[model samples]
Target: MKFAVIVFPGSNCDIDMFHAIKDELGEDVSYVWHDETSLEGFDAILLPGGFSYGDYLRSGAIARFSPIMKAVEEAAAAGKPILGVCNGFQVLLEAGLLPGAMRRNSKLTFICKQTELEVKQGDTMFTQSYEEGESITIPVAHGDGNYYCDEETLKNLQANNQIVFTYKEDINGSIANIAGITNKKGNVLGMMPHPERAVDELLGSADGLKLFQSIVKHWREQHAITS
Candidate 1:
């Protein structure tokens, strides 16, 4: 699979994400600068976490206006799989590719540690390797990870099985303890955890690899039948 990792100014995790996909997953991956307006032949696009644009204004607020995001938005609309992590998730919300908004953590502090997350829905390409209700530990680092949405939208998300991951212990006080969510079409996924950081046993956790593996499997299945 050909994967494109978007890189914006102040994006610190793009290299980690690139290594995870290229070195760990052994896939074809490339780094695309934020100024690039074309997606070309990439099979998947990843928006890795970090303080984009130095977190100016709001996290991901400035990065959302980058030229590459227009192509990302268009690809997502066309049903291409897109995964956004941490600040990337914030960018998705700002670009209206995902629902809800992120606010300062309820604790008003930057949290950085391994967090337990429950797989709320496993049907997504991002979480199919996890069983529903299964608990997995992944690392999180952020200050504005509190996810918020109106009651009706929240209800709709739950009803449609759009909620993907939820904190097992309310780490950031996200609404409904949601840690991640998917678009109605299931092509776009956004979450505030750093899955790339947990992809290796050397990192003290391998739970995050399942997410990338799931996507690879999904892509293979799609290609196999078509081929």
Candidate 2:
């Protein structure tokens, strides 16, 4: 499968994302600049972590307006899977592609460390490889990662199984300990944790590999790719 790793001016994780897919997963991947107009020929889109636009005015507020975001909207409308990690999650929220908004950590500090997350469900293409209630370790680095949404929205998300992952412990003070979530259509996922950073054993854990594997597996199944 081919993946496009969107790159903004301050996208520090672009290379890491590209490496995860290309080097580790052995997939065709490319770095698509934030100003690019189209995402043609890519099976999936990955919004990597970083302080986009220096996070000057809120984490993803400014970066959401990058020229490539228009194409991102178009791609989302076309039903291509979109995975946003860390600041990417903030971008998705700011762009209105996903539900809820982020707030400063409950502790009012930047958090950087390995976190345990419980897989709530495996219905989406992003988590089909994980079982319900399975716990996995992934690194999270963010200051404004606290997730908040209205009670009604949270209820709806729960009823629809949109909540994908939750922190095993209350680390960031996210509402209901939510660590990750998917769009209503399940093709788009936004999360505070950095899954791409955990795909290698040398780095510590390979738990995040299955998230990518699930994407490729589900995509191939849908496309009937026999190879």
Candidate 3:
């Protein structure tokens, strides 16, 4: 499946995402600038981590207005897989594509380290390669990674099985240790961990590669059905 790695100004992890998809995952991937208006041919959309617009107003706050986001929204509405990592997660929240909001880390510090995460549910497109309750290591780097949703939203997320991954420990003060979550439709995923960075064992882990593989597998299945 072909993928588009959306690049906004000051985005640093776009190349990492590209490398993970093209080199490691053996998929067709290309960098799409933020201002572009079309995403007609891509099978999936990836929003990589970085301080877009220098994180001036807020993490992902400015980048949320990028022209590409409209196309991203259309993709999501069309049931195309969309994965947003780190600041990309923040952008997703800002765009209201997924529920919840991010806040400053409880300790008020920038954290950079590998975090152990548990697969909350493995049936979704993004986690199909993983088993439920399985543990995997992925690196996270961010200062405002705390995730909060109202009690009603949390209950709905739980009821719908939208929560995808949770930290083994409270790494960033996110409610219920949520490390990642999918939209109600189960197509869009937003997470704080840098899965692209961990796609290579040489980088200390290859656990993240399963995520990309899962996406590809899902796409193939869907395509086969529709075609």
Q: Candidates' TM-scores? A: 0.98, 0.97, 0.98
At residue 4, candidate 1 shows an lDDT of 98
Tens digits of per-residue lDDT for model 3, 1-227: 89999999999999999999999999999999999999999999999999999988888999999999999999999999999999999999999999999999999999999999999999999999999999999999999999999999999999999999999999779999999999999999999999998998899999999999999999998879653
Clashes of 1: 0
For model 3, what is the C-alpha lDDT against the true structure?
Answer: 0.95
lDDT of 1: 0.93
Best-first order by lDDT: 3, 2, 1
Candidate 2: clashing pairs of residues:
none
Alpha-carbon local distance difference test for all models: 0.93, 0.93, 0.95
Encode model 2's per-residue lDDT on 156-216: one tens digit a residue. Answer: 8999899999999999889999999998988999999999999999988899999999999
lDDT of 1 by residue, 31-130 (tens): 9999999998999999999999999999999999999999998999888899999999999999999989999999998999999999888888888888
Candidate 1 ranges with C-alpha deviation above 4 Å: 225-227
